[model samples]
Target: MPRTRPLPSNDYARRVAGQFISISETRLNTSPPRRLHLNVNILHSGFVPSAWRLPDADPRAFIDVAHYVRVAQIAEAAKFDAVFLADNASIADQIDFRPITALEPTVLLAAIAAATTHIGVIGTASTSYNEPYNIARRFATLDHVSGGRAGWNAVTTADLGSARNFGRDTVPVHAERYARAAEFTSLVKALWDSWEDDALVGDKAAGRFIDTSKVHPVAHRGEWFSVAGALNLPRSTQGHPVLIQAGGSADGRELAARHAEAVFSAAQSFDESAAYARDLKSRAAAYGRGPEAIRVLPGLTTIIGATEAEALRRRDELVDLIPWSYSLNRLAGTLGVAADTLKLDERLPDDLPLPGGGNGNHTFFHATLAQARTHGYTARQLIRALAGGGGHRVVVGTPEQIADDIEQWFKGGAADGFNLMPDALPDGLQDFVDGVVPILRQRGIFRSEYEGRTLRDHFGLQRPVSPHASADSGLTVNA
Candidate 1:
């Protein structure tokens, strides 16, 4: 007969109760604190159009892998949450004056991932141009290779240049692009969930390698995509690479609420940013997600100097380097108006309708318009305030001042953090890391050391569990 297990004694129960009370006391003493997340945008030379023309800047840095690697190394040393790479399929910018987004994002980010261990690698891929399967696979592979430090920024390309590159003479309408994007994003998430966490058995003794019943075929048939089955590879770490979105339209916000784990926002004022955040979180709640499910990181451009006057001088110097014609043309492009229409000393046109008749970039248009209207700035003053950039908020100050602005935004519920675009790369980023990061650390809002390895962990997001594992149902494997 099997021996009977002994029941717990009264003394044992009292000991257990004592241990529980101790743990309860500890929990009472400690509460979960809000942390600030920071990511750096490696925009070729930097945010400034004339950044490459700096005496120490490299003209070829836009295409140089070494230059990107150096920047990633600096960000890693500073313990940044991620390094982001933006993409454009065509020559959208005036390449004659400045560098364009030349390198493909995922590819470049993979190289950056190889060079750094802790920093997350996020890359933009337009749903308008690419198939969902390819994107799902590419990011999954990146996650596997980088030890789960990959993120996909789903975006819709609106420019005619990108449309023509994809064999379309006319750009798709705004609604259609977003509709397709919604389907594309859903299908990608399904594909990522096709394989169960325990699907790979690898049992050498029994010669049973995989639990075929555990792998699922998504069979997703949507208006935009029709995927037959499961992905070719196993489910990646962190389940799926973090989904990030950057759009400010109503449709964009809805898409973000449903799919995006993080959003890169563009707002010109604190009130605007706070309102945006509140609206976005409410939308997420409507989708049955918690308030903490999404992170709002507004785009911020910083021009750092030892003093306020010096920072202004630096801003002027960089702005001066950009030709007036280039600035006018760029602003015109963003506003969807002819360069001749914008007078340097005059305010923007009163009836500046949506760019491309309401199909252009809504985020920048609204942000730039808000800045102009709020401050009553002329075209020249607007350009100066933007620090030669188009839409993002620009902060020019010393390290302490920069820290103060960041702390205010973070605590005021305006932003979870910022997607920082320094005035220049390498040196500019180095200044922030060396000067500003210490101040942030001292405030206890930022991390001194990385708490985890994966990008999701860095962002304080939970690792998504596969549906197959949760449902415990039969799965059909595709050949």
Candidate 2:
């Protein structure tokens, strides 16, 4: 029998292919063949702790729409691929050392859409704490409002405090949470597809607006949730806003392979990141998907300066600003080993037996240990190097040096792109956009002008349609 189904377009592959073409087609443009994918990881007003304390930093920028808008405008001016926001469901510990997350990402992104154009807005949302229908509608609205410059970063809650706040006695099992996340995503997409792309006719001449036949109810009855009928909103610009995943565990990788177009990830070294990227692509191939179907972007924290000495000074300044106790406890929580078991000058005891199963934070613990082993550093040295964040790669250098590292990694096949955590907020990003982006664009590694719209478009991905809906058919999905 002939095939009943046609092949689906690779949403992630298209973006990668576009970059390859941009690099190869020298005659089409004067730009170089260099391809750069940059995302500003807007973590608590950007990565630097003293960022809020900087003279240029607005104390209340965390909650102010204008601050985000101004930042988005700047990112757009630099022709960045996207701006990413990381969110947690619960406010776990407020140490007064680092800034805590305040404004919700979806709302913040919507406000940002009004202030800028072209740049992709990616937001983190948990499957554990939210209902599928609401999240589906929210992203759809954001996509429409932003003309399709929207993406959803699917996350499963990892904090115990979040479970308590949600009226649960305890956190769900890790594997169980992954199972629910997978299904939750499926439900959300179904809801987005509830209405076909052209469900709205607006035919006032005949007193008809919608074709009810084109609208369908998504009656989902699954182990974790059962959403009924169609969602209130229609499809957004990308069909389904670009699906991004950020879990590093084995289970996490499996989920990314099955669905994610791009993944936000971390590894301590180029070798580690290369292994991760290789594994994800290999898994994708096993699932009968192409290697370019999922883009791997490891998180990187950078302190950039005009010169090497200036950059080192900047790094030292951030290190000096970090409170010892805060770093101590954070590291302790990561290892699932005790704080008293550790001393500032001592080594991480190899004799401390590894957990039989769960540490609640395996990725960081392993990465930190790997960094220590790789660099032959002791506890104090490691803590100083890691600073506040556990194990993401940290680089302090001149703009040219930073670009060189990124280019080396990209060309070496260790990464498809980077999720940048600038040491400070407004200033940190400003220095990068003005100082670094131009060099990459001039080298033909990054785009000077946006070739397409939508988060998927930036990634060279095709818009995903509802599974049941044909290319000609609109979806009628009820959430």
Best by lDDT: 1
| Tens digits of per-residue lDDT for model 2, 221-286 | 999898896988666656768889998889889989887889988788989899999899888888
Candidate 2 residue-wise lDDT at 320: 69
TM-score of each: 0.92, 0.88
- Candidate models: Cα lDDT each: 0.87, 0.76
Off by over 4 Å in 1: 1-31, 470-479
Candidate 2: global Cα-lDDT?
0.76
What TM-score does prediction 2 earn? Answer: 0.88
Residue-level error in angstroms, candidate 2, position 138: 1.5
